[model samples]
Target: MTRHVSTRRAATAAGTAIVAAALIGAGLTTASAAPTAEKTPGASPTKLSASQRAELLRDADAEKARTAKELGLSSAEKLVVRDVVKDRDGSVHTRYERTYDGLPVLGGDLVVHETKSRRTEGVTKAHAGDLKVDTARAKAAPKGARAVVWAASGTPRLAYEKVVKSTKKDGTPSRLHVVTDARSGKKIFQWDDIRTGAGHTQYSGDVELGTKQESSGFSLTDTGRGDHKTYDLGGGTSGQGTLVAGDDDEWGDGTPANKETAAADAHYGAALTWDYYKNVHGRDGIKGDGVGAYSRVHYGNNYVNAFWDDSCFCMTYGDGEGNAKPLTSIDVAAHEMTHGVTSHTAGLIYSGESGGLNEATSDIFGSAVEFSANNKEDVGDYLIGEKIDIRGDGTPLRYMDKPSKDGKSKDSWYRGIGQIDVHYSSGVANHFFYLLSEGSGAKEINGVKYDSPTADGKPVTGIGRDKAEKIWFKALTTYMTSNTDYAKARTATLDAAKDLYGADSAEYKGVDAAWAGVNVKAAKGKNKH
Candidate 1:
């Protein structure tokens, strides 16, 4: 069953922040670079100078000592501290370290690098990207066991953090994982497991138990910093929000060896995506009605990608092998969740033009979510999949202005282009949405700069977001059905604009102009694929 707990300060102000992307095309060209985030989506990225680094390093070490004491750590444990990234969004963070309290009461050691967002302190991630808290309680001795956790660069502060579970000499972590809100210091999600018997011993061999060595410097997404990976992090939260449960769909095993790292990576992305929708669009859940979707990490056998299953209302991600990594980034999560939202509201057909529209809608909202979160670890940009890189070129998977840049999408929406994989075909709609929301010529909105353009030589105009979203939602739910085609989508959306935004509202004009910018029209000409 789902649980809904309120701590404090819940408001609807998000309605004002997040709107659909339908900016009018600027009619300009993109820059040579694939678009630098300028900032991570959550907190601002703070690069420390040599002198500053020394100071931060000192403070980090001291902080570790204080935290160890607070957690009742012993002297045999040695802890290492690092600064939590300060994203461009100016969020509150609680950075921790990986250390042991002398030797374990049992025969091992306790070390962790757990960081979390300080929501009670109002430490929100600007990019709406989630904050990852890395904590561990592994072995410290040379032969007994040792677990190493590398600090991910872009983590935000954790709030209302408490140890929900721990393993006694019995060897079971009956309970593990804690959950809290970023805006208010409330215990929205928590669990406490008491181990009763010896845990699985074979896991030690598969996980390099006593021989575990420290590995570092794995960037999660794009940005020169932020986005890290963990071999072991055990702990989880409710819903797909934090899938550390070691299910068939999960990518990693949430054991004492690796629970914290996995939880940090998965939950950071999920929470950030959640906040993006809630704070920006006033959406309650995937359907704007307060439903939480499950996010399963460590999916399948060495799976290499992440996917949103509309049928299951869940997202599954892999650990990536043979050069393939999990696509579970903030934008990626947003892309997947938006699918659920679209399925619920628009039910756009998954084939042909409507399919492309549906797919693009996911990309559109995903990017917007990144922008809304505005973190320093992961900034909002018009690029996709720059984090996982499935490609080794150190570039993103797709570009908004020129979908063809990815060598997969049609620059313009041709009538019959829907046969392609929805991932690729989504380019047409992605470009159109960007143009609609961030209308033409370069300028800064929410501290991020975006420049868009029209298909033809003409300059386009945009309808404001509030009206645009209402119109889009109306079109999807009221007029269109599962089999709706692109042509039908156009008609339905226009009709929707007229009904709610007024036949002459700029929103109405925008729907027309947006379609016009994409070369989508009523006629059955060459514009027809």
Candidate 2:
């Protein structure tokens, strides 16, 4: 079975598949960059403001021709800037998508880093060399496939990339990207882009919501965070439902019986996620563009899932079993929104090792967002989907402290891990983050007892969650690429640590130790753990 989002398998369940098929018949398609480290490192990194980011983007675009020439690319090859990040020291990291002869080049994304003095430091690329494949050799793409250059993992070749949009059995939308060999028509790689999470009627208690005061009543629109709005999907599986509104500022009674209760949860979750990114990480919004992504609650009847669809750029939550349990939990909301952030920045392709990293990134930030909220009703814990009771067993969907506790996720990295479902494969990074933030060994946090074990039987000393999350955020935004794997992730974090806290700092050592705890060791002679 394929993995869609979060912890569940992707194959629609027995009766669920029929629902999914019916949703498909009605068009239920939904779904869902560079890590780099400083080379000519300077001062402590500070995130760029919205205007600065926009200006840098413009500058990057103006220099595209120069960049192409410096990289010695052919005339047929062109570069389009996807994102640009400026460090506190004036160094710039620019991410770009590539096209060859006016054709999209899959796996052709790359990042170029420039020192403060404007000297090119280095280039991180998904495809290492120039495109040599002949477009003439490309055959017709199957049905919905689009011709392109497959350069994500292996050798650059002519390929067709197709996005299959469908609904999963659990009402989890699937935006599956399937790449096939253009000549042979053989499947090369595939990944589901739809990422999931959820909210109250269960998680957060009575909480304040950001709403717009309309003449008639109050609308579930938060003007403070890019005018983010929440809507009620009613029981339909397609299209955005009506914007949730009320006659007064007050909303929800802390129960699923009140439809506005779910909307309040969803809205509150979006606000928390927005504030967490803006306040802690300096990210203005999911795209760092100050434009908020809306949310949809009460998706399908007993849908049993919540997901983020990049196509609509919105969060969708379902009414879990019997419509009594809404999948609108704080952590789940944060988790799903982080997928949007990942899409805008690292652009991690949703498959294999990269896909695992993609999911782990969301989980990591989801936990961080929860802890940041510090709500009395739902104290922070290193557990995912705990409030939603996704499995009906009163256990979380995943445990970061020890991922294997759930029985499906792997706690450590191993060979062929890329072949497993991404949700399970994400365990390695999740464990690493936990060990990095809280260290290895038995301990209790927020009334939750955890006994984290190391794969190598080595004790890992933590540098605290604050420093840990900072290192991760830097690594993800600066060093990571769509094709980065486990080893690459380790290096990226290490590099991020060196940039943030110095190479000799304990935080850097902690990162190394944490990676080691997950059995992803640094290369020979570079092992500091």
Candidate 3:
């Protein structure tokens, strides 16, 4: 149930495990380092000439090879340089994507940290240990074998399943793993491999994007943000779709008169969200890994919804109503990308209270990203889906200050709150975040009015959005787990606040008060800061 990439899951589904095993014997490593040149932060990444970027990548590749050898990576493993980030202090962090036995390894990525003098400081591995699993007898399941997936911790292994009848619910198969002490048959691991969780268009006004330079010209692929690419679905619902290619890199005219306008908005949103995480939280990208997830626009005819699919590791959006209004707004794009972040960290299952927390996390960061952009055309607000107008009315889909304004969303937590739909239950946490950042009662920010109230009628003081965002992000990445509930969330944020602002700081007090405002109590006996 842990949220992570699973290469074996896909291999098992495709019956390619055997072939992958064969390829593992001849694995090769490629790593290069960038030139030891100092670059400032304000230097425009897009302004780098094609030749300059090529030279940088070439150096990075060499560094990757050296790093893999230093790490003692076996021939069954390969390291692919994903990004090489150089700090002003001359330190560098080189991120890599890993493959095992020529197949993608789910939790095998790592980052090599170097000092200003280019000395290897150490490495941060996503998962440790050599991937040496026996797959000779790992055959595809036969018909009616009762397929069950096995996902091991750190390193996952795939094996065929065999069902056994036992005492359980009627028509329900027994959930058990077959094991043997003999070396020939040992159930190394067993768990469900299915992972599910739950972007863009022309609505956003004049914005900037990171695009890819091509031989024909530039395309809508963002090299700065983990190489995220945007594609036009062409009104279809399947496949990776077609890449949005054009001769000129400059896209969109600030109006829906051209379809590229929507594409531009989506691309811009992705870039903004990427920058928000990198600058604010020191995260490389969604999943804290350099790999980028793509966006698919123009999905279906007048499709009004946008969703993040973990299966494809991409975000899909539908043009709304007349196909002219694309759903790719700044906040919406951030919201979807934050879902990917949640999947990698905390991994709140998209059901029950955890599901509600998952949704609210997206809403929280989505608002942060909007404010971070400081775009004049789309001023930041505490309203969700305000630009999309999915409701037809001028009102936003969800109100953080007063979530109950949506009629269906809850303003505060209560018993059986988990029984409610995740989207509605998310209102409680959204209200808590608003109260934490803006306090209770009426206030105005960026020309938007908000009147947040407490369930206990106790006034809560504001801590500002910047501090609140850091606390939440810290809790998500450091404290939360896959099944964190509301009460647990209260503890997590409190711990996060203490870690960032100290136990006696006002920021810590605000986190506790905000949860109380939402009727969530910190668990007794839990560490209090």
Candidate 4:
């Protein structure tokens, strides 16, 4: 059962200024050095400075007119720059979102690749073909349904996108997007942006946090990382709630019984996640704009779920089962935050195979962030939500090495996978990531044992977690689009691997082998193995 609550806020504006940019200028052949203390070995891409981002953004904007014309876009369509990336070889990739006759065009996003001299190399579009839909106002639509163009799948058509704000039975906040065909007043498609994951105890130990000295003592705001703050939603299920603060800097006694304890855990998770992206992947923040998203704790009594909402630009967690265990574990926090990353990058629609990929992207990064944290109390492992025990049986929520351990998730990709829920469908990529990072068969890391199997009974050798994560991040931000399915995902990762490692490098082979391990084999000639 689900509960419907009404808090009507306008959709996150499509015209919101693009926050991320790149430093991919001509003759930029060398990569920038990582910060000494947080350096990640073999991480080649450079982080963009504020001035560089502005410069690259200007470059992207200046080229949009010519790029759109080359793509054969109609005069009624306009392109807005969403992001930009550059390779070490002096090549640039600019991402854009499309608008049709002043209305947002869902699934009209694209990436234009160019060489050092601005020669058009290629383009990846979420929607192919021309946009010739009639812009005249539809005769009928759902009450308060805002008009837009739906091009994510099938044929492009005028549609209404309605967002219903509510709370799920599991206490997960809902931001359901309901799309209806405007002309016929019929349902076309819908997807919820509120991504949910279950979790266990507050495992983040006595850790360092970034806090600000407020007039009223100290606030849970981290001034260094985009001023990210934590709030206590109390028992209510909506709104931002109150910002958590205290006189002294000391926070939490490592117990969920203390409301401040959960707040501290949430705050710590945000900081660690921020550090992981900035240090490991050179990402500034969730949107790559150096702006932090907030967090809310104690949402709904006995609520056993944690979620990330793009509309509110924040994360919300519930006190699990007995209200004694808050779902603010380190992995859980990273898991939710990574959703925001996926939303901004690939904008993977939260449905079908793309949704599964979206969820897997988060899981992959969440696991990576955990290992990078290297906390003694919360050792990293392939297991997710191992500390929260949301099921009360002391078992984890999901297993990456072999996702079938949960009995609901599939261990490998198969036909009809898109028909299942995204969480379960995510097992395919989750298994792929595990194989890519740790290889097939039995292994142990940080005292956790895992045994992964291949679809064709073939053995796979890992290229290490560090390399695996870098490849995934590159593929996601550079090659992937919203409609990318499992097959497209394989190509994206392979392309990313080729970019980071050479086309003939072992890392590239590892990516192919990992995909084949999960039954996502490449075309005959391409499957060298």
Candidate 5:
């Protein structure tokens, strides 16, 4: 079974369709470019004095110290700042985004704009009409952009460079400033904008583009290698990762120990996902570590959905009582396991746009894994969770070709798209993957008919999943983060294609065209496509 964000099966026991029949759904999360944020560079800020500026610098230094205290750096991580120009606009708005000790943040590429617009009366203080102050120049975000992601994480605080404001020729009658934390979307400072001599002026911060964050836990070298090690959780042994099953009542308990016989049906399914990645992607462990992640059989008593927890780094299983046998699925295993890999690598958050991309990334690679495994036990195909009969009628969970047909997923990106469940939100990337790998058309594999159309319903020929897998893998390793979503995913992958296939190479062109087919315009940055 394909382990995607959701387990789409027949609705029997409080079943969720992943995409509701009436909900009608969504796509790749673009970052928000609007004024939903507090203290946007173009937004107002907290007023400050020359003394305050000095204090702010002091505060930044203090932050540096705090970070060092909390996250001790290898001499390498202590000073590395991997900040580079990102986003549609080239350092276009906010002064600059910076990373402390090389920790990666979403704002490293986003330029923030905080401006104050106001009017003030001089000592003359006469009711002024034309003498009044107002904003004149308007700066727009760079063109060919998709969405803007603005958010705050519990960890990762946002830092600003310098603050600016508007004032009169002599001085300001009133003043304003805006301060924000780029990493966490937290507002640092703000103030008023008043007129003195200059009618209206906009202020900005010094762009200290943020660098990348160092790894927080368990490094790649931390885990051992190969079948040399057997994983023992509480019960038994699993060579690396395993897929176990349970009775209708007790679903995947994997117990790390076995209770009843390890369900062959469940074992085979999980094995497909495990061996697929190992044989196809050459990924020994989900994180490329030799450490084995145990797959517990029968997760819950008649459980409905399967999931991955970073804390455990393993995929769990579930039984579909009455109408579902989700444990006996291939894509589901791959989908869940990939979540482990993502947790280790990009570590995208599980909410909002980042959540959607996180889910989609799992599905994309899961589908690719299915393609690579080509196992006769679980024949490799594009259909997600084809083995699990949620409907009890033998129909699979979700379809990769026309996700919308499943009634839970959206085929394209649109406004208010983030509202859908991440499982459904995955459509944008799922569709993009379909476009990249197979293009748009009705192709039959394993007798599964897949007819996928581009965003505009136009047909797009693809580069096939084999190459697509490599390119996407490269992107995940080189350009993504815990916060990356669909738009960023596309950008990262396009950039990856060029890196792996050579600039302007056929492979790169194929990737660019694939995104275009999905209606995502090619962008720059690591975004080569």
Candidate 6:
């Protein structure tokens, strides 16, 4: 039997404020520079100005000690600050990566929230409880011992085999993660890490790109973000081809007459998406670590798809028909890059309701990025892949207003929704987002006409895209987890709105109404934190 492929197939598989303004300001800095080094135990790294750096170090140390004590961390385990943000009100949110016996602990990360007074408020951990198991006993096979692969759960893990299973129908070997209890050799966790990810000059019209100045002329590398480069695949399916470099910076004309034209479009799309995240959410690049992911274009002849692969931390794009048109439009580029963002954060599982949310997250942000660009040619809208002509006819891949227009997506949520494909199930969240940002009834945004309705027949009042995007982003980063279902999504967005706005604010209520509009009910008695 021929196996089915997800609409979001991978060639492989695969935010906060300062005083509010400061966090946004920090994100606006696009210059490519090495991020602060990960501070080791008892070793302080400088941040901010002299005075502020000292103060931050002191506060960070105290918080780390508090976290270690609260979590009952052993001497071998240490908490290292990855990033820190301070609100204008004095509240501080510090993200940390845990290390076990000087070795990095995959999935062992957490966030520490502290009051302006330097008191520990709470912690959001990726994994629960202390790791009391011995690492020495967790040995791996000689050949399949350890490999870094992308897991559907979000971030990559150091997977080792406790047992190797029989090969699957796909002719791929199955190496189950060895999650045995450190003390009793009992299994603790297990998952398969495989997933797959871009760019341009010819396809995207006339556009400006940020490239790095190299001895071999200027290369298609963005120095402003994380050295993100766009390469020409030379029509081949695999391997990173040559970089689109030249002495003159001007990339392409409108048509794919020149191979560089498609590359120019792909390159420009990546830059815009990077700017969107940085300017809107204060996120610096996909991983939020100031590292730019690379993009590969022209994969195979008439490849028809694009993807974000975490294994290589890059994006890949394919030509549409006869290798003439490439799927490297602004929205499509942003859509692929947003996949990288989802993988690093909430990591909603790649199957079931969570998987739908994962795909919707990309679509939602991809649309937002297009709107942010305000490009006259693309013209931001609620439609996805409208420019790509993926369907041969002029119809877009998916419609945010009425997802069922494609005949496979669900405009609203219902029980057992997880049984459907992720691309189809994602319609529920996409519809919810549209209703929340644009409201119900007939309307036109950026010249695109849309008539959105609620499953409950109760009209919803939109809170504007600006607020809606922030709320969804906050929920994804701070609240939603790998297994968060649709119901949990409702609660998470509500909590996110409460955090950004007040608990009783209009935006908070708008989130609740929006969820109800999608037929996703809020959990009973779930109060805002």
Deviation of model 2 at 471, angstroms = 0.9
lDDT of 2: 0.78
Return whichever of 2 and 5 wins on lDDT.
2
Please provide, for model 4 over 1-529, each residue's C-alpha lDDT reduced to its tens digit, 9 standing for 90 to 100. Answer: 1111112212222322111100000001011212122122232456765556557777677766666776678998999999876555556677899999889999888887655556566677787667888878744555867789999888999999999988666656577899988778788888888877651125877888889998879988999999999999899988899998888988878888778889988889899999999897777888877899999999999887888888888888888889987888888899989989988888999888998898888888878888888888888888888888867899988899999998788889998998888888889999999888778888667777788999989998887778788889988888788888888788888877876766777788888989999999664442222
| Poorly placed runs, candidate 4 (over 4 Å) | 1-44, 137-141, 199-201, 523-529
Span of 10 residues, lowest total lDDT, candidate 4: 20-29
| Model 6: how far residue 492 lies from native, Å | 2.2
Q: Which has the greatest TM-score?
A: 2
Write the residue-wise lDDT of candidate 6 on 106-178 in tens digits. Answer: 5566665655455555555555445653456334424544322112234333334344554333222233345
What tens digits encode model 5's per-residue C-alpha lDDT throughout 55-112? 4334333343333232222332222121111111111111122333343233222211
lDDT of 1: 0.45
Error of 4 at 379 (Å): 1.0
Q: Residue 400 in candidate 4 has what lDDT?
A: 95
Q: Candidate 4 has what TM-score?
A: 0.88
Q: Report clashes for each candidate as comma-separated counts.
A: 94, 14, 17, 6, 76, 40
Per-candidate local distance difference test: 0.45, 0.78, 0.65, 0.79, 0.44, 0.67
Rank all candidate structures by their TM-score, best first, as comma-separated numbers.
2, 4, 6, 3, 5, 1
TM-score to native of every candidate shown: 0.49, 0.89, 0.66, 0.88, 0.55, 0.75
> Candidate 2 residues 391-491, lDDT tens each?
78798888998999988889999989998877888999999998988888887787888889999999987777876788888888877878878887887
Where does candidate 5 stray beyond 4 Å? 1-270, 323-326, 523-529
Better of 1 and 6 by lDDT: 6
